[model samples]
Target: MPKVPKWVADVLENVFSGFNRKVIVAEINHLHPFIKTIKFRGDLSGVNFKPGQAISIRVNETNFRNYTPSFWDSENGVFEVIFHLHGNGPGSSYIDGLELDDLVNIVLPRGLDLYKKEYEYHFFFGDETTIGLFKSLKQVIEENGQNYIGILELNEDTMHYELKTRYGLDIVSSSINKAQNAISFLQNLPDRVWELWQNGSFYLMGNGRSIQNFRKALKEKGVNSRNIRTQPYWVEGKIGL
Candidate 1:
């Protein structure tokens, strides 16, 4: 076993505790296409996360995906994650055979997961793969009566993941051909969500190329680059995330 020093142990406990015996209680595909929500039966009292950060899950070092925590009902001891099934990669393939009580490893959640502390509006742009982040953000903003627009892309009929939308959310359809659709969404939105890109920081997570285009679209409209934040799930022409 690997021995940890005292200071390191406390930091790990504060930052992340890779509890060796974590298990899955249930796993199901959601209403949205190509996404699956995995529910875990773990010790929830130790769970902690900000709005947009995620945990890096690993079957092994090579087989891991940064998963955004989709929902957290701490009192009920439940937490969920939404994932997109794009190929036979670490995240999708690993999720396939997950049965109740299956054990797995989770990297402690870390990042600057933030939204507006004081803002009137918010908007989200992402597809099936980025929906995990979208779901978490939508819930927080909606409860505060904030404005939101979520752009989602998917294939014809792949189903996975569930979003609790009170006022509901705007879902824009998209595909790998992001340039074409992104252009359309930016030009025609009068009801803009500024919290994500104003004094408050917005988070971006997904394929690098698509994110590049999305950033360009906003920049052309004269939005500041500092206002937009991104975490790339995959880059263009790359495999296994």
Candidate 2:
């Protein structure tokens, strides 16, 4: 999706019901050189959002991207989204260009069902793109008194601030090493991590190859396929998933 210029978004907002939202950029934080957070405020009264749901933003007349909310307050009509500005495409440029007080149009939230309250133990695995989902999961898991663990693969520059000190997730962060396949790193994870993998329902998101490798390891340890759930957010060489 291409980035939508403000003038065109404003004109189309009046004609398309899907573009009815008028969100003001309340705050923006540069969490890292490659990661940023955006806070949006508006009349979000009619919106029905869930922990894992994502909103599609019109970057341009023909381009758009889906992003999950890291946090939100329905009563206050505000939400925050953490973006991984990889600087590889138009979407990155669009997000990088956004400033405080900017207005934009976004579609209503939509995504796969990720949470199952019946499960007493939960496991989450993903990369940087999975941070928002992890944040949301942590809140729900704590609120419901469920046991959960997260394992993430992030580039060295973003891993510490994201999973370690910031969110304080009980996670195993493997920094990406240029000489090795990231998925291969999963096979050498601590024995205890493998032990826990067999005892809970797994939610795997992020890089397709990494998810496949992790899921394969779980299955080899006798975890039923039914015990695992996944949504591949992106694939190498593929635009989106």
Candidate 3:
């Protein structure tokens, strides 16, 4: 839940406790100055998770935040989420202060229609907040022998290399005018690549304004609306989205 009244949040928490799972922090890896990966272990036998799904965790008495798991092993009851520590908000501060063995209650993964197996090729576009979602999708896409490519806007160019080397992803980066730059990159792709991806599924996520601009660019290029999936994690000057 976004920012709600404390009483309402408490009531909802009580009602949803049946679907909650208590997870203990197993590991924490600081991948960059602004990014970290957290692994949690819990009993998740009944929790069904699909690629691109997210779990909500309360960061404070009246606020909850959703995060996508970058990796999951249901049999081992383990999952990892990559967090982008931007700004000093409740979610960021809460995650930043997490320590080993810290216990947290997270709602079971919620399904989303972001993945389509029918498409042979998948395209992803977003910024730092999207890394986890893309990583989750990449696992399934690779297992199914499907192809995926993406672009991420990062604050530092070195992060591109780190992500590519660490995750084995076909991702490029843009450091300025992210949305417009990404559109230009896509539009200028070689004809063969363009043809192969034009009908493929596109998952646009992360910054809200960037998503809007990217979506418009895709539509103008004749991409089918049904082929584009968008989930804006946050917008400028907004608390949560």
Candidate 4:
């Protein structure tokens, strides 16, 4: 939900809390200055999670934020989510201040249909906010023995995060204009690389402007719009997306 009235949000929260699951924060790790990974333990026996799905948590009485789980073990009743604590608003502040054993009510995972197994090759393009989603997708793709390539725009300090190394995503510093930097990087790729990925599926998330620019570049390269999927996590000057 996007900035609803306080009374309306309260009513929705009451209804949502009926079926929402309460999870305890089990552990927290700071992967970078602004990146934190949190593990939550709870009874998730019947939860049906799909790659690229996000769980919504009420950050405040009138605001809710969605985050993608990086990994989960239903049998063990544990799941983990990586959060980029840009700290511009309540969601980041709430997540950053969470302490061990704190109870959090989270709505079940739900999101757009992002992953299509029918495609042999998958391409991902996004920034720090999309890391968790990419991580979840990478797990399923590797399990299916599918090929994938990804590029992420991250802060220079975050470039050394172990998760990025483990996921093997190409990282570009955010010091430059994000959308232009990403588009330039894609345009500079060799012809052979484009040949291999031209027919693949593309998943674009994170900044709305970046997705728009990247999508336009892909189309100009003769990639079909049908092959691209986009979910903007945020936009410049917007509180939530």
Q: Tens-digit lDDT track for model 1 on 120-234?
A: 6565656567776777887888788776555554445542233325224444445666645756866776644432434444455576777778878777777777777776767
lDDT of 2 by residue, 81-148 (tens): 98988756767888999999999877767777688777888878787888888888778888999887
TM-score each candidate: 0.76, 0.83, 0.94, 0.93
- The alpha-carbon RMSD values of the candidates against the true structure, listed in the order shown, are 5.8, 3.8, 1.9, 1.7
How well is each residue in 1-241 modelled by candidate 3, as lDDT tens digits?
4699999999988998898999999999988878889999999897668878899999999899999898888889999999999879999999999999999999989968478999999999988898899998988999999998887765553454477676654454554454877887888888899899999999999988888889999999999999999999988788857
Better of 2 and 3 by TM-score: 3
What is the full ranking by lDDT, best candidate first? 4, 3, 2, 1
- After superposition, candidate 4 runs with Cα above 4 Å error: 156-164, 175-177
Task: Give lDDT for model 3.
Answer: 0.86
* TM-score of decoy 3: 0.94
Higher-lDDT candidate of 2 and 3 = 3
Off by over 4 Å in 3: 156-161, 168-178
Worst 10 residues of 2 by lDDT: 174-183
